[model samples]
Target: MTTKERHKVLVLLGPTAVGKTRLSLELAAAYNAEIISGDSMQVYRGMDIGTAKITPAEMMGIPHHLIDIHDPQDPYSAAEFQEQGSRLIEEISSRGKLPFIVGGTGLYIESLCYGFQFSEAVADEAFRKEQDQFAEEHGALALHARLEAVDPVSAAKLHPNDRRRIIRALEIHHQTNTTLSASHAAQKKESPYDLCLIGLTMDRKILYKRIEDRIDSMLADGLVAEVKGLLENGYSRSLVSMQGLGYKEIAAYLAGELTLEEAVILLKRDTRRFAKRQLSWFRHMKEIEWIDVEGEQNFSENFSKIRAIIAGKFLSGLEYTSEQYN
Candidate 1:
């Protein structure tokens, strides 16, 4: 493959409610690009509303891949996502179309962009059960604290409230007898793609408002009914998909653990926190061309700026450095 063919990827990424999907559709329309979703939740079927999946009508005849490819009960991981996403990227490029990856799943996007490697550690069901029981008995924070003692770097990077990752880190340490940070450091590999990463961001106040409005819209669009449907369909609360921001909060409301009003408020708060985490993850990556959406410009203007950047770097055969944009 030529240089352009090898590293020709366009990623539109930002926090939820930051207009990434809308702007990405416009860019795809302009370039006749194929979109491969980078969202984790969007891969599961029947998760449309909570995941904010773009409908077929909303796609406007633009082809999309990697959405609704699995059932919600199935487990999907970043490693699987990277493999599938890379395959889609190649397939789209083979058809002479630009492969545009768009979503708020920072880890999923980063795995593709940086080619992060997952260890060959198989899931030990017994071990996982033991850890779960320990967590239940000793609290999630205590388990995270144990991880902190062994893998301070990973612990420092992960939030204490991130029970999933904390447990995974501990599991890795227990199974491999090595810290996750060490394994992660040892597997620092270069990416196979030359990515033209476009990151959309807005003022914090504006972003918070948008997040609030989006939660309201989701509620108005029957988010509660959606979660209720999932539960009624034999889905478990412990399932990872059900633990997503809107799903879990609304599930609580349905279960009578929280009032509808309280659930909505909590959902908004959690979504904002999730967005902040997404921004933090993206900020740590140095390769992105950050576009401030609140810079007195509309989406079209901001997108034009992005298009010019991508064209200059990838299509125009100009070796533009990141410093030029900074």
Candidate 2:
């Protein structure tokens, strides 16, 4: 590949349980690439079951970065993830290996791919606590209405139920005297890398079924026991990791708020909703070349199709040995 044609990163993204991890391993093996996880929840340690983190065997001896790097109690923001993930990408590219960003977190992927600039002002813990308490008492919508008064552009874009982002925007306005929408608009003007984006999607029904099955598998694979262990280890239910979709529902069930069967049903429903939201996020990215997994014959067939696409685009006539990369 010519210097101009060489991409700094190849991103493989899709909703949860769309088989991204397995396909990413094959692509990395094919292209002399290193995998850098784009998952937000997978960054935390002890979040294995809920996050659907790949096991050592599942990784197939490939080196993966940005997984299990943070403690559950430690706060990890998108800005921090972008900084660390970008450094890893740079380091990998400098070594003549391609970096494969693979995960379902659209925001994290966008932040790294575009190099979103964060404010210099530090987060005000006291102010954040106050805001959190207010939101808790008045409800997320009421807090979002308060944000509407300050940054209507952001408030209009974000759903009131999106409390995390709402809180973040409010906090940004309070700390930096600028709206998060303004910062996002400014950041959207430039991207750090010459990006090649690959998005995988499936039929909605199949995707939903896969998500439900995955959640069922998680439960069968000791998901409840995993959360139980965390609780026994002194991790609070209010921690960010515990609030993840599967973890929260399972924890609620363990705490006697719901029966196990009800928790499973809720988990499936929430996961489907999360997948829909993920698709909505990816739909807005115009750079992506989407692959339909629903019609693919099998994993290998799908892998070959993606491999051919990448090879034609980036590796045509390159006499590189795949064995050297794997």
Candidate 3:
């Protein structure tokens, strides 16, 4: 289908601490758009600090969706994100607004962008049970190592604590004798929307410093207390929600598996690794117009470049009434 025939969707995505939130808010205001959060953890209520969730005051009256709609224990998947995001795209477009998605979750964002076919991985009960038994015997990390041996691509995207998906990816390999990533690559990535896919990047040194600073801020904002409260409320540490970045490390510290200092060190290290993996995933994705934001002191110059890219892609013929960049 032609570009004019497809629905328009704007996505702002990148690794953590690359300034996606600030840019997304600006772009949304400029284009009269509603945002759908693409982060997996931000969908859960009470995960604000760790997820760096955008606050009401920060939203600047922009309508945002798919955030705080799920309790910590409720399961969410890429398939679900695609369904809801597609519906929201149509609804927002019908209301004469653009639909924008913003976050660092590569799989969730890419699934929505390309309408990825996920049904190719057939279920294998016996294989899944065997892997589960192995994980129980060895550990989630060991099981993840097994996956890394076969499907390194999928392994890079999944966290070691995410046993379910790791097991599923392993099962796909076992049942079909093909790596899960290969299966995904085999799909015809035909997008249903006229997509403006923008990616933010920065020098690794600067990005790492920003990540460490952000983690420190989250700790100061009571990320440890938040995890403790959830645990006190009888939430299982084994729950997928509890296994997210800050929650997992803090839970470990609280459980006496690690000291506060040790947990902080581990969290910072893991987060850096996660950011690297996020970039690796997005680099493999197609059609992203990358903007290097390093050395742009106040991000004013970077914002202008991004805005111009958006305007050229989606607002070519129309006059724009954009908010002043703060």
Best candidate, lDDT: 3
lDDT-sorted candidate list, best first? 3, 1, 2
lDDT of 1 by residue, 1-326 (tens): 56655747888999888888878877787776889998988998998888889999999789999899998899788889999988888888788777889998877898887788876677787888887788778886887789889999788766555666777888888888988778866755466887888899999999999889888888889888899999999998878778788988888888999999998888888788888888987887778899889743586578678978788667654333333233
**Shift in Å, residue 294, candidate 3:** 2.8
lDDT of 2 at 320: 45
Taking all chains together, each candidate's TM-score versus the true structure is: 0.90, 0.88, 0.94
Error of 1 at 143 (Å): 3.8
lDDT of 3 by residue, 264-304 (tens): 99999999999999999899887999999985486888888
Better of 1 and 3 by TM-score: 3
| Candidate lDDT values, in order | 0.82, 0.82, 0.88
Candidate 3 regions with alpha-carbon error over 4 angstroms: 120-129, 317-319, 323-326
lDDT for model 3 comes to 0.88
After superposition, candidate 2 runs with Cα above 4 Å error: 1-7, 139-164, 175-178, 316-320, 323-326
Tell me model 2's lDDT, rounded to 2 decimals. Answer: 0.82
True lDDT of residue 31, candidate 1: 71
RMSD per model, one decimal: 4.2, 3.3, 1.9
lDDT string for model 2 (189-275, tens) is 356676778899999999998888888889888999999988889888777677788888888999999999999998898788888
